[model samples]
Target chain A: MTEFIPPATRWHTLPSPFAMKRGGELRDARMAYETWGTLNAARDNAVLIVTGLSPDAHAASNEGNPEPGWWDAMVGPGKPIDTDRWFVICVNSLGSCKGSTGPASVNPATGTRYGLAFPELSVEDGANAAFEVVKSLGVDTLACLVGNSMGGMVALAYLLLHPDSARAHINISGSARALPFSIAIRSLQREAIRLDPNWNHGDYDDDTQYPEAGMRMARKLGVITYRSALEWDGRFGRVRLDSDRREDEEPFGLEFEVESYLEGHARRFVRHFDPNCYLYLSRSMDWFDLAEYGDGDVEAGLRRIRVDRALAIGVKTDILFPLQQQEEVADGLRAAGADTEFLPLPSPQGHDAFLVDIARFGPAVRNFLSSL
Target chain B: MTEFIPPATRWHTLPSPFAMKRGGELRDARMAYETWGTLNAARDNAVLIVTGLSPDAHAASNEGNPEPGWWDAMVGPGKPIDTDRWFVICVNSLGSCKGSTGPASVNPATGTRYGLAFPELSVEDGANAAFEVVKSLGVDTLACLVGNSMGGMVALAYLLLHPDSARAHINISGSARALPFSIAIRSLQREAIRLDPNWNHGDYDDDTQYPEAGMRMARKLGVITYRSALEWDGRFGRVRLDSDRREDEEPFGLEFEVESYLEGHARRFVRHFDPNCYLYLSRSMDWFDLAEYGDGDVEAGLRRIRVDRALAIGVKTDILFPLQQQEEVADGLRAAGADTEFLPLPSPQGHDAFLVDIARFGPAVRNFLSSL
Candidate 1:
């Protein structure tokens, strides 16, 4: 409905007539980012952190924003990234609504929300935007590039497009291309949003006309896939909600705890995220294919990227960006002559494990950074 | 939507004021069924079939209906559960709209569609209705009972509530109770239907007011889960739809072949099945747990079922009613002193494997019936 910018977020302006990957251009577009710790005099100690969809640049609390961030546990001082030792820069993706120039941003020419008029966004576009931000920071090279989920795709695009930008890479639960299953899931989610009468071809206002129901359904479907069924079975089982929690008048209302959990999780998310921005980012993922860089060969595309070392981490239980994709990334990096390690953790949390299961992910990341 | 009855379907009126499982009663309600082969003088060469959520009574083509049925591959003369030897009967579940008295059927008192006025249905009620049909056919004891997906749950209820009504049981891709993951999927499907403005609290007419969009979404969701990701990966891969197949005008429209597949599948299903009936039956599934019969022990409740022999078959890739649930059924049947077999097939099709992979399922059913 509207942009949601974190207080800690800072901005970096891009060159005028910022070109988009697929076509069209945005004028006076800016990238949103937040940094933790100081940049070393050499500038080589800076690590760029790219984010998954739905996260702002606030990876951890800072002086400007004391609130905890989505990845606070994995990026703070004495943490996996260890901001005390390395300055970490996290940027909101280009097509996102988190203070980044996106569909929610006012059009420079029309002075209205870009909405459907926004250019078809691509992961490569986000990667290029982040590269601009990194260039503006006067960082010729970085210690490591970190990316999780959709961010992993962006990072890959970054490395492929800009050579030797980072010494090493850490990819968490990402894929080389969009698989059929993931495409279907994302397609259905977009359909849910568009099918909503309130969505109104991306013209709905933030108030009564917002597509709350569509957004709720889309988020619920996402939450269902983000975690493993094993976790749901163990945590909620067949537990029914209390009578007070139940909607008694409606026959097919909230009958189970899992349903209620999804309802609450979705309700909190719908208003905070712009529907148009979500559609763009999600469609971008479906369109991402490393093969485009390799003339219809994904492996050949991976071979084009050069890095000193790479580590691909994934959870065994993740059904969306599964463990095999992690192995693919590791193998591809190895083919590119980069010393690579693929770590498949046995976390039951699925695709979101890297964000929450810090105990398992922390050490691997720390050891890799220490080696760097 | 109006009830869709095949010409071959025959009806058996339940006793007036027939009681329901959770409460309430149906007046002059009827069960729809189709049968083949002749009953022997002994009246023991009979096999009864209960079905999944969508299918009607026409499980296989017969003299009265030459049209192929849903399980046409597995249930004809000289086939699995061969009608040449054992008289075969398939009944549409009580709450279904396929020639069965359900929400789509007329309420005798008001002479209008029952809609939400229909009482809450359960697996046990379906079981009882099928049992009534079997008794009315003068079968003292069924030679065997075959159930697939939701039917498996109904068959188990039949055996538990009416001991010795069936001598043997075949439970295919079914669970003793509703798992949290399954419940969440069904809950979302119901929500999609109810959230549609055209659904009109189940009062919408079948003409212009039909909740087509809601039903399409629900069916698409169902189709996504019915098969495995492994199958999707192998079948569709990341193939894009042809330019002609793509809905180019809509930004978030169909792009991938998988999305097109889902669209066609959902479009074919939405109008055929009644929205209210889908809601009632889906919620019934979420409410199905054998633990109710054992004071909160699903295993103990499953143990209450008694039969001469039992076969529980499931596919390795079935995420909905997973392989573990089939094992649970076998374990419980064995605990109840029935000679039980658990067969987990390596079908790529997942939960719907039983309906399509007849080459594998056929021999198993045939051998099990040969033993009976």
Candidate 2:
């Protein structure tokens, strides 16, 4: 086993100008983020890893666990991201429960949680916040900016907005625009949260229940699309989780392993996630559209990207972010004369494949990083 | 347009035995059905068209309108089913509100709708009910049995239970086994109904609201899987139904065409379908397993089928009942030494493609019936 050392980190609040997607005057905003690796003398060895819907700036490794961050296995000293050689930065996205300025964050005016009063955040706003976070770190340009899922959309948005901020980009399991099915699924999830009596119109600070039931239901729905049917069948199937039978027991019960898996997912999500933040982030993801900035021409918007290299990775079984979608991103980058590589990861894990099957995804990412 | 005439139709009640899947058994069950066309002197012109979830015995062209039934375009006088020569019958399925013994039907013992107390039904029970309906028609054997979706499962179950009953079977957009994702989806839908405050433990009378919100939510969830992402994007890519927008309106609101489609479906379904019956029928579809009755050997179960011919139709864009699933059905029939034909219909309507694009499906089905 390799000996690991937890990195000493410092948090900073960067000023972020809130940009609206539907068209309006930009608003003043700020973001909270952290840096793990050291910036080089030339400030060119920077790698920015943007976060997903919920996670914060602690992407690679954190202080308490000593086991690295959520993507620690893929981003560490001599790891795929190679923290020893390059400086890595992660940001807690906008409209998240993390230290980022979100629904849970205190409003400057009211000194209370922004809650429902928080302005709707778009993916471009997240990208803008990330850009501010990088600027606060005194980095003029980035060697590579990596993001996954909604984070990937943020990275793409970063490229579209800044144009000359990053040399390379890695978009993993994300789409150029939110598909109709995705919008529909997210809408239902938002409805689930909205319908919860305890949600209190997003002002449930006094309610201890905090819309847990609705959040749990939303999480259950999320899990269904997060993983593929084949994976669920192979792992869970119709096998019963428990065989204990009692008198007067309900005859028709959940006798399937998949049900248990989904239940566990719901339980954990309800425990950790804030319903308001989930709603805001999901809406941010649904409203993500790079082409909207360029008058609906996706290719034209991509052509504005001045990145030297781009990497697009998609899971074959990912119905949500599908291989075809990643190909579109790669094609767009290629059309812009950027050196683009499209990697299709074969796995039955679907949208979760990027997070779960590291053995297959890690090596490909490492190879790509090394090449960069 | 061809001039059409209404046919004199006769209705009958057939005894349907109910065997609960979870535990308890229901005896002396009965099913209601209707028949059209004529039986030959040798009693060999029988053709069964199993109706889908919630539909009653009305499957073909009725008297008032000249147009055929739900499948009337393919089941009329000179249509695919050839009413002139074959005896056609459509049964209102068990656990449905279409003149059949369902949750809404009065229990002879209690003199009230079975409600939550209704015994859990399986596809086997549905097939048994259809068997009684067919037998009551005075036909010892059937020339062919045709079905779609849930009805298709019933047809397959009939083949599994009574191997020598039908000479041919046509299963449209059906699966050999319920997919795990489908099971998960159904489970969530059931949970939605059970969670609804107005559900009143499934005892809401016909005059009551009947958990409309829960039913609508369930339909919304169900509709997502019924169609493909491609179709959704093509039809409704974030186009708002309401043109006027206020400052406080939701950003990127249900502007997509697909949203309207889903809304229409949910409204229509909630108006026509019973919440408890939907739960029961969905459960029946989920619990359907041909191999379970044949000692866990699916191939062995298929080998036991004594059908002379089989035809399987799958929709290209159907994510719920994918083409691969239909192929599995066809493969099983072929393994049973039954002459089989598999046709994959290309349409954007997804699982509902068979119902929506009747013109194409009608011709294909008509040709197949002519050949038979």
Best by lDDT: 1
Write down the C-alpha DockQ for each prediction: 0.82, 0.51
> A271 in model 1: Cα distance from truth in Å?
1.3
Model 1 misses residue B203 by how many Å?
0.6
Q: Give per-residue CA lDDT, model 2, range B77-149, as digits (tens).
A: 7766778877888887877876667777666778766777788788877888788778877788898898888
The total of clashing pairs for model 2 equals 10
The residue-level lDDT of candidate 1 at A289 comes to 94
Q: Compute the interface RMSD for each candidate structure.
A: 0.7, 2.3
The sequence of per-residue lDDT tens digits that candidate 2 reaches over residues A1-372 is: 011113333445544345555443233445556566689899999999887776656666545335456786787788788888888887777667666667776677776767777776788877877888888788889989998988888899998888689998899998788878888888787777776677778877644657876786788889998898778768876565666532125433465677767888887777576777788789887767667766787677777777888899999888787788789899989998999999998888999787778888888778877887
| Candidate achieving the largest DockQ | 1
lDDT of 1 by residue, A1-372 (tens): 568999888999999899999899999999999999889899988999998889999988988899998888888789889989998999999989998899999999999989999999999999999999999999988789998999999999999999989999999999888898888888888989999999999998888799988888899889988988888889999998999999988778897999999999898898889999999999999999999998998889999999999999999889889888889889999999999999989999999998888889989899999898
Native contact fraction per model: 0.72, 0.55
TM-score of 1: 0.99
**Deviation (Å) of A200 in candidate 1:** 0.9
Worst 10 residues of 1 chain A by lDDT: A1-10
